[model samples]
Target: MAYLNKLRLFIRKPFSGLCDFNRATTAQCRKPLPIWLRRDIPPAGKIKRVKGILAELNLQTVCVSARCPNLPECFSKGTATFMIMGDSCTRACKFCAIKKGKPAPLRADEPQAVAQAAQRLGLSHVVITSVTRDDLPLGGAEHFAKTIRAVQNQLPHATIEVLTPDFQGNLDAIKTVIQAKPDVFNHNVETVPRLYPSVRPGANYARSLAVLSYTKDFAEKAGKRIIIKSGLMLGLGERRKEVLSVMRDLRSVGCDVLTIGQYLAPSPNHHPIVNFVEPEEFEQYHQEGLKMGFLAVASGPIGVKLRQHCHCYGQTAP
Candidate 1:
């Protein structure tokens, strides 16, 4: 019966002006954003400067591709997480705003282009992520290695963090990226296990966890001290206990860092927000995560605001 109800909700058309997916839309399923979730508009001048640099380099950022609400603020602050592979993603995750289709052929110059952009931005901490490129052999692990090396060559003092895909649980692929020696290796599980089929149909929760576990073991074996990080989105109909269970699972796998944030529905066509998790709830989760042994926990509306929030309270190897 519950399954049938979900099926009905999927088929139903969203109501009125609040329903448009292509343009700005409102939360059709939940109430308006709370005061804490509301953010200030970024400075126009700073935004333009960042955009100009990204455009010149022909680079993609998860900030723009995922329609992150924090884009203006991140860009205005002169930091952007470079999306390396391409703009198109192979997996059609219901909650993502990135277009899903045949991604363009891997640009051989991307490594250098990304390095150039980082140089132009004068970034001291560079975060690199990519669309899930399942079409590529080794799940684009080699490309990730190349990009990491390129960034290191350009900015020897800067810290490099990578938010990567699961590589279909291929240990060899995981090893390839770990060997690149990024300061932090991150892979988001996205949501609780029960919501995986509906929210992330193309991904497997166990496979994602395995990828983190193997990366941790591989890094330790190589005598490398790399931070293992993961993120989760709330307001996806997940119960409090379920959220804690996910945190425990992450800690079990030796994940050093965790990020929890509100899951804003990118469009009306995307997964509907089940509830707006309160600021207090996020704080509660943060406290619980620390107790569960995460070296650092970033939670709340701007939780995984990656570059800024991630480095706070975590021990990074020098």
Candidate 2:
């Protein structure tokens, strides 16, 4: 949404060089996906104080908003990727279940709340994410930085991973967040390049790459190699070659961690699944990625592949 709005608003914009708006809507590949796909995944343990901490802190999470299937598993382990800002998103990607519309203002207390949640959960690794805040000045990058800083202030020793949006290609805005010094900078590339317009309609591949590239480049320049990570959803009609190409692109940008999960549509309104990536296949890709020299690779059915990798690598956060 921001991309389109900016494209229409400014004749020549920075990201305009990255995506072609005219060629965005041409893909229409279709394939029959398996029917018995939707299943409730159960976690192995209980996060003792999770709900109370969330209620007390007034924080929201992609785990709940996007109905991430890994919620129980992740939460039960006393770890969470706290979704900062709020529940509403600025854009409506067809593949996402997060509510779409003009989102509300940033909750002034959220940063402290997330930090509190981390402290209460004894979270050695805290993952913070947000809905695309295209409506904000600085695209909410300042808020992201604040949250990371707050969490650090509380935990002081916990590793932090932020799953952020492309800050409308404003390198200055991205710089602000990077300067906050997160343990890992993660921005999901989401899908294959070809289906972006129809699947993640509001985002861009090159822009996504640019975001990762900028984060990695800056982290390196800062004399601290913060782990740079990203994820992909399979079963969206993406090809094997395309997946490998994405891996290569990530590698080229110095991304150290990657997650490849089988896409599971939340509802019929969202994009239908084209297929299910089996666990075996996910393992194949995981090993391939290891061979490719990725420091960590998570690939599997229901996103079980990288579930523990982030914990291990992230726990080492300084």
Candidate 3:
């Protein structure tokens, strides 16, 4: 009887405008790709130019490796989140698109290569992220420090931000990256704790919160002022109350920045989308995050725009 009811729900057409699960067909129940996720066609020349630069530097970017939907738009703008270490990830998170396996050896010259790419692009603000490298002794913390220093060497005026893994809750590794003095230290919680087992089985919700908290304490003790940032994804079978609670947890840890976006399944085999969050709900989240005392909040279906805003802090673009 339960299976029959599910089948009935699956065959119905979704209501127009809003994503009404009750009336949604199987395709709609799967959260039909929304219009907002789509991007306008960028000039082919600009895209090719950026690709050539990345190729010449022998660099990898999460924009490419993770199959981010904003690739075309970001590539057109000649901006990318440099994914150092390598393109392969060690953990197999259900929601991510990056390849999972035994990663190849880290390239010795990757730091300088990333620096050169930033210089060529004339980026005033550079964001760097990497695949989870649990196999490394320090979870690739040293490599991250080296890349940060290299980028600074080439562009001393640029503000650097790092979106990193939890280092498996190794405070020493987290401190290593902090000592590098990235202007912004971002580690996303990804989703609510209730969904962790299914969505991010390799990660721990409490441990992630501790990482953020410790980063803030360490920075203050060292007399270095650094902005702490974290993000979460909606439409991942998370309740609205759970999302707010996650925000509170982050704020409790002195997190200064926040970003929220809808979860788009990377493939049919990956985690299925629970629902398509409406744009108005995203706006509500943005306002609520601000009320929670976050220095900045970016939430919407247009994830690329939200991320750009979060990184920029509403300052003049780079």
Q: Of the candidates shown, which would achieve the greatest TM-score relative to the real structure?
A: 1
Report how far off residue 17 is in candidate 3 (Å). Answer: 27
User: What are the runs in model 3 whose C-alpha is more than 4 Å off?
Assistant: 1-30, 304-318
lDDT for residue 219 in candidate 2, whole number 0-100: 75
Q: Mind giving the per-residue lDDT tens digits that candidate 1 earns over 1-318?
A: 442332222112111100111111234324587777666687889889999999988999888777776666667778788998999999998888889999999999999999999999998778899999999999999999999999999998777779898898888899999999887788889899999999999999999999999999999888887878788888889999999999999999999878787788877788988788887888888789878887666676552332232222343212
Candidate 2 residue pairs in clash (backbone atoms < 3 Å) = 81-127
> Which digits, one per residue and each the tens of the lDDT, describe model 3 over residues 122-233?
7777888889999998899999999999999999977788888999999999999999988778899989999999989999999999999999999989977787878888
- Alpha-carbon shift of residue 93 in model 2 (angstroms): 1.1
What are the runs in model 2 whose C-alpha is more than 4 Å off?
1-48, 303-318
Off by over 4 Å in 1: 1-31, 303-318
Predicted structure 2: lDDT: 0.70
Order the candidates by lDDT, highest first.
Answer: 1, 3, 2
lDDT of 2 by residue, 177-288 (tens): 8999887777878888999988988888999999889888887787755768788888889999999999999999888777777666666667877776776787778777
> What total of clashing residue pairs does each candidate reach?
0, 1, 0
Show the lowest summed lDDT stretch of 10 residues, model 2: 15-24
